[model samples]
Target: MTYFVKYLPVTTGNSTRLYTDGRDYCADLYEDLRSAKKFVFLTGLHFMAEFGLIRTGKPSDAVATLAQVLRQTGERGVQVFLLVNQFWRDESEVITGGHPIRAKIMKAGELYGYLPETLKLFDSLKGLKNVHCRTDIHPNSDIFATHHQKTVVIDDRVAFLGGIDLTYLDGDRWDTSEHTARHRHVDRTQKFWHDVHLRLQGPAVEFVRDNFLQRWNHGSLHTIRKKSLNSYEAWSQHIGEDPRHVAVEATQDRRPPALPPFAQKSVLSYTYPADGEEPAAPTVQIVRSMPRKDNWHRQKPTWNTNRSDEWEHSCKEAYLIGIRSANKYIYLENQWVADEDIWAELAAAARRNKNNPDFRIILMVPYEGLFAAGLGSNQELFIGTEMEDVIKASRSPATFGMYALHQHDRRSNVQGQIYIHSKVLIIDDAWSLIGSANAGGISLEGVRSGRDEPDTELSAIIHDKAFASAFRSKVWSEHLGVPVGPTYDVHDADRFRGLANKPGGKLRFFPGYDNIKRGVPTWFPESLQESRDPLRIDFAKQSRIIPSLSRDLLASGLPPTLVRAAFTARVVPSVPPGWRCWYRWHCQLHYDPTEPSGRDPRRAPVYLKLRSLKYDRDEVWNYSDQDSVYIGKLSAERINAETTTAVLGVIRCRVKILPLDEGPNDPGPSMVLQFECMFLNDRFARGNHPDFVRR
Candidate 1:
């Protein structure tokens, strides 16, 4: 009943190079883009038109910018494609007066300049005939969902994917490896940024390329124009273009680019001790958090869809699996660690390591995030408290260390704290996972009704000793100011503890981190936090509701034991063919304790109701119309955990459908499925330590 599914297989014969900061990433990406011959693909939350692809003494020079490279590349008929995240909220939140969320939006805009930059970037590529541009909007954008993947595939032979976006909003994303803050500046004050990226080649590149094509072929150039951005309507409407059509039409006949022959290449951007053993090309597996529903039919296989394509959350699965599999030490460096499930797993790991004195769990994150006044800082404090509570509740003996990164001058004057934008996890110097997906609910949790959906994400897990060891050593050396020798053990937990305690480098104890016992702050309400940093949907409540339903069936002259079996015996209706459907839909099913069932004195019957729905790609529907379908109520039964057979009474299931019309090159009808059954793999219901769910 667990929702965890191993979606992607481990791919071998892949060469990888890791980048710690923006300067190296920019330099390497620039060189690769210049070498691109067949096609160039890029996707991200924000792709600024003025973002410099290469660092120069004069940042104002247009020659080093991405727009310039894309222009030149398109002119050479290289077929450049870009998919950037653009949302309706970005416009309404900024321009709409008296909007409910305008204050928060304005605060964000004040910190990071709010510009119609997605449009700006698209317009910059206007004159280039071969350069194609599109905007990827989340289906639930009205509820604040947005695309968050930062990835690039060049010529279908090489790929770069990670947390760093090609934008200069908060600061120049192209900072040096040193992360100096003394003189670096773009528009406002300089910010020290610490992030990680991966350059991959071999069979693994195919996954990244396919991901780009899937999104590009299905996404649009812009949302159908509504109010503002009159310039947007003028530009897109005048052309009357379908970007998906344009991209697919362009690449339909092109032969798949053959994977280049394997070569022994260095995967490190820095010189580090490798125990005198050449690291083999890593065996890499690509994982992602993709949306469940789209406007058109998809070709990729999803976890739940039998022959159909739908949502996939392999990225979250990979994180939980990697943490559970850690044997010696766990190293996590992410921009945000706000998800309770992730923190719960860390707590469980600590308890598992309680008997081993050498066991350590280390976390490195930003001292202060982009919006400190919002959920970011509050979540940091809440996480520290959660971890502290677990340590007490479980009485774990594992050495736990939480630290942040900052820059300082010779006189030890605080220059700036480095924004830890890296999403990295190294386990026992043998396994590593890196990508753009943060350790936050928005990036890891699956979709839910009346709640935010997970961000679309792309990441890779590498199972290579050499690669993981080199990465840990290189990063730990910079933070601890200690040079690693050829024989130094990266996995020795004691060595790290000693070095971290005597840190003279960037590593500092996280601000406001304490061992005091406290719940989430009264000031930072969980409801507000859920709106911003939401948690995973709880589907295990079916266990409680089903039993109540069974009691009601008993009062209606149905035998107690047979009541549970009857539900499963009645076959559930299958999703109809000719409809490309989402495996699950959003429905509101609440049990009101005050309103008891008339059949049973102690039980309450669950009622199903509809919420706001979208029937077409652009229109919102408040009530069901001709375009919608309401399948009759069905019974979903509980199963024995091990036997996988029905063992409990029926849980009433509701299926609500929002049907969408086919596109120009239609494969079939697109349907939104909202059904209630049971998700057995709910971790919270699996009897995890009570402190995990405790305040």
Candidate 2:
């Protein structure tokens, strides 16, 4: 059996570098294109004409129109192969009441012609030599599947791979990972684009090049409508019929050319261009998910290679193996995640290492997507929910945590949205992959019902610890402002958990945008204290096992039971102020081996009950936490008024401590709730508010 359906052996003696974000990445690519002597292979899901270069924060950032640069490159005799997915958003298999809408989209696809209306900015480069273009349906994939790989190989010596798009006339993706609002830079608007891309040099480049040729040999040629072309490009141009332009009539009833036989043979090395230099890299492996099929209806699977009737889908295989082999940690960043098989693999990994409390998984996904109604967004949300449930239901819920990147406006430190669109996975800082394969059913065998095939995907994997460690630190520096260190250094799990619970810090944890609106806690880490925890109340999960005698007794004559015998509404008992009411509670527990009731090793219970004056809601003894029980200077003003679905009046709440279990027929007595400090009274003012679902 063939081990690699479409994988090449690890390419050695190659150097690789990482680009932190979109700004400099885009700029640097433009510069590389300018210096290319032989060929530039570019492929993506979509295209944007005006989507050109940006002004990176660096002094060397170049400012140029990407289309113009491409034209000049072609004029300079550099081969440019540009392949994009079918120029239309796919239709759903099951149609409902929205027939007209689907029909309109299909019409739009046709009206846009072959290359573009297709895309708003793709028509301007119709006439250039050594510059070729095509629209692909990923011949072997489901008709609904897209050619979703993003790669740029320059002269076969260097390659760029990641989850970035070039479909903007305006430079919306120019900021660093810092992601701040801009005044007037590349375009009139500024967009927060948090993405990752890689620069690969060496044998892996050969494999990436093969992937491109396989598609080009089997893809379709696109012809644009003459009318739309003329309308959009009426410059100092020709007055009559244009040979370079083809109308729908000229292209009507046309069939894509059949693929020539080139068996699934892959090239691990190629002749360097006349002016080429050796690709420098220590080692890298090329892995991709491509189905080997007879696109031309030939009797054999491929022409050039002996291997036939076999397919290559090494991306999913690599991902599963990486996750299963992960002993310490697994870090993942993708636009969307919806693969059940991958989730199962992760769950199994967590179960195996029950002894290692630090063995964990961390994920970063976009807060939300632009295509909320699309299948991608729907599946992503579904998977995220299921993943959280699986972790919470497991023996140890703290084994997994997910986060989202947040970028406050550059000028004013106000919270803003930052989109995470990189498809990457790193395991134990020993193995990593960077490319266009997301953990989605669509990406992994699209329409798992088998009615449709998976989307075409590509990724490069490396087993170099030095490279992986360096890459991890580079990413951490961008996201957490951590200093670039020599070894692969990530935040300690304990320290990370501690920092999350604190209030403010430069690299504070962020709950995914969806979770935050749903009233979830941010950075549930019980330590660091937000860089401003003046009174360091330990919030670490380990803090639960502290001594229990701290709550023994007080010299003052106060109530001994957990609940206050009687409580008042306001500071003054005589005056019931309708505005705000405060409830304060405190506790520090200690256990003695000498005592009978406090001998249990587990944590004690801190219970809470909430009620409204209008009898709108009521709850008794809700478990808030175990170790220590406390409610700050909690008051009516602190909670959001209009946002919550509860009753429309001041809320009344209570705190209770359950009796500790002791010897037979002897339960330890409960104690009164204490107030140590006052919680600052302020209104909750987040932009989006979701109704809290009562469990």
Candidate 3:
């Protein structure tokens, strides 16, 4: 499989450097900031100006902070913009339906606040004409969703995007890749901080620049009582004023900032231009998950005809495409894996390669203790149990493995698992994706049931073989306590699995089942689960085209007969009877994982049973011959595929056939429909599929 996908755009002449952990990223970021000649734009979910960037060689005053660096840079006439997520309001100020704890904390002592360092930073930066600091709220108005993207663009020449945040509280995010534990105090102690950040040096930096300027200049439309939310004001003002005294919400309108002279071109224009060929240089593309609203930015749309106000879920589309394209192996590491859609795709891939002895699906996440610290829900246990059932029912139960990282201090008999905060996905040692989004519904498929907005996210799809393979080896070597060489080649899946089970390595099987018996604690209340790690999603399975299928056909001005002739001729060869497949129309579709059968015609799940196919010669369609056609018998009793009628018209538009490795000679279809993420449950979704269903 190739690293680049034809539908997605790719930018050439870009250089990339990877940081496996936060310590190295901070060092490089500090030096880069010190060398800045033009301007700097930085944003993150949590931005702490007090975060140390360098060791000053004194025990009492041991390091220089990010605030110091920003001060020094501003003194040199460098324009600086800092945009950070704003979730907490001062005790005296509050917005409508904002921050659940605000009312309670105010009633207690009238001194409620979070992240005092942010306020300190704002006060310190006062009167610095070259530096600007602002707090941004997610446009969706969903109190739970946040602006979670961590991106930095330096001088419009280099950019960094990944999961590493610029704050440290109970856990220091500045820990080395080794995950060493050197002290017991919160300030001095270093917990394992495993993350991935990419530094890009080339024209691709414009994408990062565009994203920042859009968020930075978006005027605040939210209101507190009658007053508009402040975006260009001091944080300390909120602390001084009383929420009860504020009257008539005043409007705060902001104009879009001027773009750099060199950034007049759009990133979409840099796509592969030559037909039937690609550029000789490595490439990169930026993808984002912006909400349906907030289209006030000055940047152009990704598509020429599409409006900027339309919802953009490019990050989700990238993940689904990457997972389905893997041939040899798929490696995933993230803080959480609660997204059922992602799990469904992974299970389908495992089923396809169950009989291939060399195929492997490896995953790494935080160990039990650390996992529980973030949230109370054991989502991994629930999803992991279903996945095990899927693989166990298959012939190759060992094809899928889940492990976590652990480090032991023999001297003090203190041992704990290294927190796996990185969000990364690598496929076949050829392509990779790294960014701030976790493998969960909140990060990927945003805006659950009652929520109004999705968490804003940014990720880059990279197709450079050298960078992908070398970074994969570096991460694997750290987990297995061995170097990547003859014994541990990048393509050697068997060796990687063998080393994961051996002692002395940091990797250990995630004890999901055991944690069930002992019980995982819910540090937060049950009501907050949806807010912390949202699980509800209502996305359509086949809705990710560059342009809507119906619009494309209509805009072409082609007659119905010619349109059907063009698409119907693109079908794959027939598989055996009883093989599961997806039967979908070209219209808009919706699937709700929570309630699949509840009377909504649009939300009804669709699946089919392959009956037979009569080929017309080969790969060609002669409409005159009725016998030369493909047919799918609707016989699934569980999903009521035969009885449940959809309100929308259904045409025999497309069918994705999954060829179970029934015998040693059978190779699967070249292209797959990949609409199975909308399956209702385990029985119909995984076990009832072609490979694992009992005959």
Q: TM-scores for all candidates?
A: 0.63, 0.61, 0.63
lDDT: the better of candidates 2 and 3: 3
How much is 235 displaced in model 2, in angstroms? 26
The C-alpha RMSD in Å for every predicted model, in order, reads 19.3, 17.5, 17.8
Candidate 3 Cα lDDT to native? 0.54
Candidate 3 lDDT tens digits, 1-695:
33443444678888899998777888889889989999999888765667776544456223357888888888898888877665433322432312222332222212223334455565566678778766666654332356879999998889999988877643567767666654222232234557889999986787788788667656241212223446433343452364332322222325434434543555456564344453466778777776655453343344322343355566766677668777677888887765656777887887777766767777788764222333212334235344554455333544676777777666655566677888889887767889887777456655344222456788888876777788778888777775775222435554544554244566655554222212222122233334421112111221111100122222444321111111221221122333433333332233332444323335564433222233322222211222112212122233333222111112233433343323312432323222111112223322211111211
The local distance difference test score of each candidate is 0.54, 0.49, 0.54
TM-score between model 3 and native: 0.63
Model 2, position 208, has a per-residue lDDT of 77
| Top-down TM-score ranking | 3, 1, 2
Error of 3 at 177 (Å): 1.9
The per-candidate count of clashes, in order, stands at: 6, 36, 4
TM-score of candidate 2 against the unseen true structure? 0.61
